[model samples]
Target: MVTLKQIAEELGISITTVSKALKEYPDVSKKTRKLVRETASMLNYKPNSFAVNLRTRESKTIGLIIPVIVHHFFSSVIKGIIEQAEKKGYLVIILQSNESYELEKKQVDLLLSKRVDGILISLANGTADFKHLNDVIENETPLVMFDKIAKMVKCSKVIIDDRKASYKATQHLIDIGCKRIAHFRGPLLPQNSIDRFLGYKKALLDNGLEYDSSLVYICECGDMSFEEGKLNAQKLLKEHKDVDGIFINTDLVAIGAMTEFMKQGVRIPEDISIVGFSNWFMASVISPSLTTINQPGLEMGINAFKLLYKEIKKKKKNSDFSFKELVLDTDLVIRESTKN
Candidate 1:
């Protein structure tokens, strides 16, 4: 209930001077700024965010759209983004799309309506239509896509080279004398998943190995949980008894597969070799540490924030900006999962 007027009256200064001092405007003396801040803290005088946003045309907040927060990869990315955003005196609002296109669309609309200064999004799994994203672009809202992106949207993006990384992983399996490689792919719609699948197939074909259609399993069960991975691996093994190598879309899935393999009394790297994407923490901790592609999730998160910040600054300058697709290189991390 304590308005700027009350603070001004108590301080014996004009309301405009109090306002400027609270905002730390250089025009106000440092002594006035300190006194106003102390008084505001005592009074618990919180400025109306809507009014501040209206005046500056900036919410000083960034919206982060992620598929899921439970996964280690997304959690790490969020940590990196928040750390960087905090350094710049910005706040982040997180929204989970839950891997649904409809939910993602609704979240995007809500963020736009809230007038977020910028949006950093990793598209949902089944998001094929990008009209919602296009709406954000039309509104001239700075947008940066990371990980799973809308290919049609020409905007700033930060992602690892999934295709090349997958190729290296598969090639490593082949070099280790394992043929009949099976792929456990994620949803087909996300470009990153498609790219990783392509990389797996390319490695097979390039090495004069036949691409077996029977060996490809699509895990489109909404959640990429360890249970799903275990079930899918079991089904794949049932159908293809000769599957000697496995390329999973995620480290979690690979862990699940390893569990099932061990239960089945299968010798790892002896009877079968395994590779996974995203070098999550469990990958290194699990028995027979997983061989995976290090996606640089935290680095991608930092880069995404920087790109969004640049876009916001460009908008403030009233300058036209070109889209940037930043593809960070990936590394094939070798461990006990694969042999030779």
Candidate 2:
């Protein structure tokens, strides 16, 4: 009920000054801004978001599109985004694409219609064509991509070195007495998947190990549920009985594969060793805990939002903005899944 005008009257300041202070405009002194914020808080003065948005033409909101929500990595990323967005008084609109290109396109359209200030996304596996994303770019909507992104998207990006990480995982297995290693790779579409596969292949070539095509199998799905992992594990065991190690695409799938291996009387780290990407919580709990790549989900999310905010500010100022490609680091965690 209390208004900025009342605060201005009480402080004997102009309403324009009060408004500028509340918005943290550079024109206002820091001392004045602090007093205005404190007074507003004391008065419980909740600005009418709709009215303010109508005036500024900015919702003070951002959209985030992810491939899935039930995933531990994605969940962590969401938490990071929410925490970071809150600091700037920005609200987040989260949407899941279910890894479908059509669904992803729909989500983008929905966010655009909502008139959010900016968007952050992790592209779905099924997304190959950039037409829908380009539409957002053409519309001058600030966009930032994280994790699963396309190199051709021409937007700000936050990601780890998937290829290098995968290579280290494979090499670790080989160093620990693993021979005839197999790979459980994601689908060929997503850039990370392709990079991981290439990394695995390169490690094999570097180690003078045979790069056997028969040893590699695709393990991808909407949620990357346990079934796909188990099925691929079964397939790998049945066809490549001599395989002593596996580099799986994700922790969920890797855990599933481990389950199948256990049921089939395979001894983990003794008969076979496995490593996975994205060190989900389940990785540490599973028997013979998974030794995997620790992808920085929180960092990726925070970085994505930071980049989105920068673009949003630039767009608002009608300033020239260049793309930022931020690459974070990954760690190879050694655990019970691998022989020490």
Candidate 3:
């Protein structure tokens, strides 16, 4: 905890001289700057970020809120955000809402209280109200949403074409001769989930296949866990014996359903074909490898932070800027889970 006063006293210079020298101000001689920097380094002196922020009116930090932490896609997103933020000399403060609306609201409040320069968020599954989000805008903070987002909120967003991606997934199943295709959709609240479900249904009808409500399973808890997938698989088996294919919302859930089907003596692609979303790493290593939609999590993160950074700069300059909606692309990776 070395202080500027201590460094100044050691150098027998005024505190102002020491501060300016450390900052490499032109008013201080280059020799003095070099000496002050060397001495500061030797003393392991660290500048107080709070004091620097107060002087510049910028925290040099941003807040990031996500729905999950252990998820592969989200982890990749985090890495991209951190890498990009570091390049811009900014730090990220990450918080997980764990899919709870209340927690998401509170986390927003916490970041606002800290007076972060900007915020990037992927809304929680249970988030239906936008008051907390609107509060950030009302406070004139730069905000960007990625992945799961609310359309009515006036902010920049980074996301993929969920409906189009899901349509491709479901159409692939239909193309492979899956006449009776079922769906394991995410919770109803998130726009991505709703769009994905719509895509699945539209694909069925477009291909002259019947869309059955009974075949559509919902993850009521909104966690979209492996256990939920397994439970849905069990329910599907009991309720609809004719289903020959399924389009799952996530890779983990698809793997869980695959595991369940295998245990029940059902052969993948032979008895039933499956397609999942998100293209998680486990999708490739699993027993028949899963066919999935490749959501660009890393690219999403990079673009999200880039948008937030731009908005932050604009806000700082008091420049008028238009909100942007960036939709990244998605691809369907064909694997052994589906018929060739």
Which one wins on TM-score? 3
Clashes of each: 0, 0, 0
Alpha carbon deviation, residue 74, candidate 1 (Å): 0.6
Q: What is the C-alpha RMSD of each candidate to the true structure, in Å?
A: 2.3, 4.7, 1.3
What does candidate 1's lDDT look like per residue over 36-90, in tens digits?
9999999999998778789889899999999999998999999999999999989
lDDT of 3 by residue, 1-340 (tens): 9999999999999999999998889999999999999999999999998998998999989999999999999999999899999999999999999999999999999999999999999999999999999999999999999999999999999999999999999999998999899999999899999999999999999988888898999998789899988899899889988889999999989988999999998889998999999999999998899999999999999999999999999988999999999999999999999999
For residue 72, model 2's alpha carbon misses the true position, in angstroms, by 0.6
- Candidate 2 per-residue lDDT, tens place, 145-260, comes to 99999899889999999999999999999899888999988887999989999999999999999999988888545457788899998888889889999999999889989999
Pick the winner on TM-score between candidates 1 and 2.
1
User: Could you give the candidate ranking by TM-score, starting with the highest?
Assistant: 3, 1, 2
TM-score for each of the candidates: 0.93, 0.87, 0.97
Cα RMSD (Å) between model 2 and the true structure?
4.7
The true-structure Cα RMSD of candidate 3 reads 1.3
Model 1 segments more than 4 A misplaced = 11-17, 20-49
Q: Lowest-lDDT window of 10 residues in candidate 2?
A: 218-227
**Candidate 3: misplaced stretches above 4 Å?**
25-31
